[model samples]
Target: MTDHVDVLIVGAGLSGIGAAYRLQTMCKGKTYTILESRSASGGTWDLFRYPGIRSDSDMYTLSYPFKPWTHGNAIADGEDIRRYIHETAHENKIDQHIRFGHRVTRASWSSEEALWTIEATNDERPVVITASFLFLCSGYYNYDAGFTPEFPGLEDFQGEVVHPQFWTDDVDYDDKEVVVIGSGATAITLIPSMADRTKHLTMLQRSPSYIISLPQDDPIASFLRKVLPLGLAHRLTRRKNAALAIGFYVFAQRFPRLASRLLIGAARKRLPDDLDPRHLTPDYNPWDQRLCIVPNSDLFRTIRHGKASIVTDHVAQFTKTGIDLESGDHLPADLVITATGLQVVAFGQIEMDVDGEKVDPHEKYVYKGMMFSGLPNFAWCVGYTNASWTLRADLTMQYVCRLINHMDANGYAFGMPDPTGAEGESAPLLNLQSGYIKRVAGMLPQQGSNSPWTIRQNWFLDSRDSRRADLDEAMVWTVRKPVAVAG
Candidate 1:
């Protein structure tokens, strides 16, 4: 027997939970179910269990707008974030609506019936579900495996090797000399946390990334939480953080040289006088790639105390004891961690089709950074690359709910993006030069050069447009013909 629902949400993670909450509360009488591929609800938080696995963005903005974060730590650990997700799911009674281990493999939309036939595998058993609307909240990155570049002589290395994405509890690294490859956020976070346990720690990278230090706890947020109501305090803090982040991003984009100097200066103040400034400096301009943040200058403190170090060099090969540098130097290590990055898996690798035609994401233009061109009754929750992810996520959920309500009032069976008014060149959905994004650029959707079609990574802009934009302005809303009841 095939299950039927009003709405089918594709993920049970942060975005999925938020989507469910909005659908249940605002869009009353709509029945929805979340299909989670994994056994757990916390998508990224549950998957990543590496040392020092914590959010780089502050929790104030990373958290849902509806749920005020009571935790004191702005930079929360993976476990805490996971717990928060679970708590939200439990409190909202969304857990009962979620079907775990149900990996959606294919979805076919029928215009005649105005419904989506979703096919999935639930514990190796076939499970078919039909829904009027499909909400994809599955995150952009692949959960099964992270991006690991094959290095020459890796097989010859006798020492233990690990990737941050697949880190397990059984692996031991106490008092071991650890060398972390890549200068991204993962490496930056792992360096400081693993330094205390390791005999010596080294962060080896081909090119440096911008590293900034932020306080783990926000004094203003802390005070606001104490003085005001939780909801009001959360709103105030969320606005403040959003404004600061937007201002910084704009400043960096406008004056790249000045922004780079200021960022480097900030790092220099925390580093030892003897430490080489080049290790913390990047060749690219600020915001060219996402910045790496370390709370309380933990990374700098570890480096300054001689407990950890940074090596700016390319790896020639993995030696038996450690990695051999292209600069004719060898770094000794007992464990080598490839904090390289993640693999991009678009839409959880689900095959989507409309009216018997397969949907090629690269060929379609993104509508409002949520809906896709020529696709009806489908929306995705893709967050910002420049700011906190949840900032855009919250807006996306609200916009989707608003859209659904508009459709219901207008008696529309489904709504799809009509690009008749959209003209001009198309760009990649994400404008980031990050390795993970670039690796899967060909498979991702494209965005147009105009409003409602272009994806602006700014949170304020997205929030305003999503809230105020007219659904009928760019969408081809349709209503199924009512079948006449026979006497």
Candidate 2:
């Protein structure tokens, strides 16, 4: 049986739920349904079951603007975030519109029909659905497995191996020495989280990344919540946090040397006397890649208390007992945790075709960081690389709502972004130097150097521009045809 709706939203995570809420509130009377591949909601939160799973960004900006985050902790745990999403869906009755365990595989758009035929699977059973518009809220990463680089002599390791993405309870770490590879957010988070329980924990990294310490709870937010109304407090706190985040990013980009010195100095102060400051310093400047945030200096505290340590060196090979370093240093471990990185996937790897022509995302230019050039009635929610994800996500959702309303008002069948005269050198859609992003840069869409086609990561600019955006500019729209009625 085939089901049809005005809009079909893919994924039921943070972005998906937010998208649904925006569509319902802004575009009233528009029928929409959410198709989630996972059995439950909470995309990243539900997928990752690591030891110290928490959000890198503050909750205020990470959460939806309409639904105020009531949690006192600015850095929220994965479970807390999962529950919050579930609550939001339930509260707004969005849960009823979600079909869980529905993995969307293919989407074909037909110009003649002015509709998209979606193919999905539920419990290995094929299912078909159609929608006038398609919104991909599925995140950028591969859900099936995280990226793990092949280590030499990995099979010779006697200890149990695990990736933080697929962490299981049965993998015992208590009283066992653990070695975690990679210097990314996951490695930083896991070091402190598993330190107390493990006999000893070592963060092994080939190169250092900028790390900063932040308070788990925001004092200003707490005070505002106590003195002002809930909604007002949330808005104020969200704005303040967003400003700080954006300001820091701007500062780093403009004055990289100053930013690097400050970051290294801060880390130097937090480091133990025995540990060298060089281990905390990165060759790259701040915001070149993402800076790791350690709540309340927990990772530093863990090191200072003799629970954990950091090792900056190249892994020569994995030995039977542990890992051998290129510098002739050996680190013994009972378990190895590969906190490597994520495997980025474009549009959830969903095969898309328009009029039987297979759509190659790489060949197209991104329109305003959401829609693709020449793609009709389609938008993908891509978050910011330098700031809180929800900041860009909210903007994209709002613009989508406005675009849909514009089409409905004009009696248009579909709207496509045309990049014929857009003048600019094409660049990678995501403006980040992160390893994961660089690895899959060619697989994603390209962004032009000019407006509409360019993806400016600035929230202030994007928010303002999105509001006053010309709907007709560089857009191709078709009038809705009259439906034939039998006399």
Q: Pick the lDDT winner.
A: 2
Q: How large an RMSD does model 2 have?
A: 1.1
Model 2 global lDDT (CA atoms, 0 to 1): 0.92
Model 1 is weakest, by summed lDDT over 10 consecutive residues, at: 419-428
> For model 1, how does the per-residue alpha-carbon lDDT over 55-136 read when each residue is reduced to its tens digit?
9799999999999989989999999999999999999999999999999999999988899999999889999999999999
Number of backbone clashes in candidate 2: 0
- Candidate 2 segments whose C-alpha is farther than 4 A from its true place: 419-422, 485-487
Residues 319-416 of candidate 2: C-alpha lDDT, one tens digit per residue: 99999999999999999999889999998999999989999989888888899887899999989988999999999999999999999999999989
Residue pairs of candidate 1 with colliding backbone atoms: none
- Candidate 1, which segments miss by more than 4 Å at Cα? 419-422
The TM-score between candidate 1 and the true structure equals 0.98
Q: Estimate each model's TM-score.
A: 0.98, 0.98
Cα shift from native, residue 409, model 1 (Å): 1.1
